[model samples]
Target: MECFFKDPCFSHEEEYRVVFFQHDIDHNEAKYNQKVLFREKSGIITPYIEVRPLTSSKKLPIQSITIGPKNNVDNAQVGLEFLLIKQGYDSISVERSRIPLRY
Candidate 1:
């Protein structure tokens, strides 16, 4: 389980993580492996894993996306909406963070 975590020292890589743990089964050899895949980007070798949703739909169960507080958040929201639409994500609800941005 701890292998899914990242150290703060790697923060400079501009990497973000999306984690999903199977709650029903302890492990699924058919679905996943301990193998970590690597790819070179911007002269940095990044480690990542391929995660497939264990559902008949075979799609990531992403229901919504909440953009965090920041300046020009509306522009960001619009861009995200356009991206979702382009990607054929019809049902996802795009929302803005209610937390007011304080400069």
Candidate 2:
């Protein structure tokens, strides 16, 4: 995906870096002291990977909610209806709110 940022002065070109996940290595292996390199778009390369333990020292719960498509009024109404039905509010109707907009 392409991303753009607005600059008030637009004085100089901006620089961006991309990072990707590499393979995991074992610490007790023969080549445990090896280093990995990452290449940039400008041909400049640098070491990126560092071998470490495969354990999380902290415990935390992650929560997430999935939402449906929201392209137009009808699509948004359908998504809202699904959410309402899941929440035990199936009596709600989107057709009741289909009145014409003033502007």
Q: Estimate each model's TM-score.
A: 0.47, 0.25
1-103 per-residue lDDT for model 2 (tens digits): 3334434332232323445434445444335335564657448766577445344833222122223223366776777778766765566434422233343
Q: Going through the candidates in order, what is the number of backbone clashes in each?
A: 0, 0
Most accurate candidate by lDDT: 1
- Cα lDDT tens digits for candidate 1, 6-100: 65654434445676453327656544445567899659998677877788986767878878778889899999999888877878988876656
> C-alpha displacement of 21 in model 2, angstroms?
49
Candidate 1, lDDT over the whole model: 0.72
Runs in model 1 deviating more than 4 A are: 1-58
**C-alpha lDDT score of every prediction, in listed order:** 0.72, 0.46
- Residue 46, candidate 1: Cα error in Å is 10
The stretch of ten residues in a row with the least summed lDDT in candidate 2 is 59-68
Candidate 2 global CA lDDT score: 0.46
Query: How much is 62 displaced in model 2, in angstroms?
Result: 31
